[model samples]
Target: MSEPTPDAPSGPPFAVPITVRGYETDTQGHLNQSVYLQYAEHARWSLLKAAGIGQQDLVGHGVGPVALETTIRYLKELRAGDETVMSCRFRWGTGKTFRIEQTLTTADGTVAAEVAAVGGLLDLTERRLIKDPGGFLRELAADPGLLDR
Candidate 1:
């Protein structure tokens, strides 16, 4: 599928909104289970971009990032016309990977879902993890904190 039509308030806080179309809903009318993952991913990417970190930032700097692992928890239902606000937080980041927390909340601030991801940066040319690129590692080290900090 293309993607949900991201509503202005339906996207994550740091994320750019995307439209969630009717096609994303199944017979039950709630968003499809698989589509929920897409929503979370979109919010994560938007968060990274807002953080001044993005695909180009990694590529031009010769670094790549990937999801080493992910954990998700679905808390509530999101029907059509429901406005959601995704919240992407930098949980932790380091030399080789980034750990982020993504929450899809309603406009009222009630949470709909929670997603946690651990992403690793890679030097694609060398097919190995990128531990340090410019001052990227240092910046990540100085990031606030997270679930485990």
Candidate 2:
């Protein structure tokens, strides 16, 4: 595990520890580009799970999280056997949309990748985006400071 960086965001972050697998690397022995996205996705889902939300919970509410856009920046190479931490934070956006920021960091705290995603609630039954997501999502999108600590 890595110590939080000085610039790390306030409030508690949802973190998942991961080890780079050989299959996730490339010829150059660094983590594949696509794997970074996978790490971010895992971090996001882990965050939701830590907040008492899960796939079944979303399905039961007839809603799911749909990513509208994502941007990732590769900072350092991660090789097989490298232990790292993936951390995620959520911030509100316009209307129903919210932003998720995730980081892949080395065991010693060196950042390997940074990802920013824009997403919103999707109404599964309606098969459409929800401009005004329900209380569950709205509460999740709210600032952590406003939530019970």
Candidate 3:
């Protein structure tokens, strides 16, 4: 597969480096497809943490992020010992739903996979989706550097 150009849009602003472990790979010596989704999930949580959102905050607001849908494209294969940088960004959608775009790139900048997920804040007590009552999306939109960590 062709690697994305340096000038290409780099998905999200925040990145977390990860090293592929033998347990994460399949008998084919490549990363398991399910693991890519796990990586994306990890990156999203990291992004939220960097933006000052955490489990405690969610619990305090009686809301938590829930993924409504997810789609992933595998571009290249990752073997054990490969180092990758996973990045994530947020995009608002209708109502309480928002989109998260994540990319996993190899040390040499080859994109191994891309994941897009539809998520929203779920009212833990009400068991339903809720609008941005805490201004999380607003804060994210206003500050591009919020997820720079």
Deviation in angstroms for 92 in model 1?
Answer: 2.4
Each candidate structure's TM-score, on Cα atoms with residue i matched to residue i, is: 0.71, 0.82, 0.82
lDDT of 2 by residue, 1-149 (tens): 12223244556667899999999999999999999988888887777666667788778888888989999999998999999999887765336676677888999999989899888889898888877443455355434232122
Candidate 1 lDDT tens digits, 7-123: 212322354444457888889998778877788777766655555566776687676767788888889887777777666654433355556677787777777888888777677
Q: What TM-score, to 2 decimals, does candidate 3 have?
A: 0.82
- Which runs of model 1 end up more than 4 angstroms from their true locations? 1-19, 93-95, 132-149
lDDT of 3 by residue, 12-112 (tens): 46889999999999989999999998899898887777666777877886877898899999999899999999988766533567667788999999998
The backbone clash count of each candidate, in order, is 11, 0, 0
Q: How does each model score on lDDT?
A: 0.62, 0.75, 0.75
In the predicted model 2, the residue pairs found to clash are none
> Residue 48 in model 3: shift from native, Å?
1.1
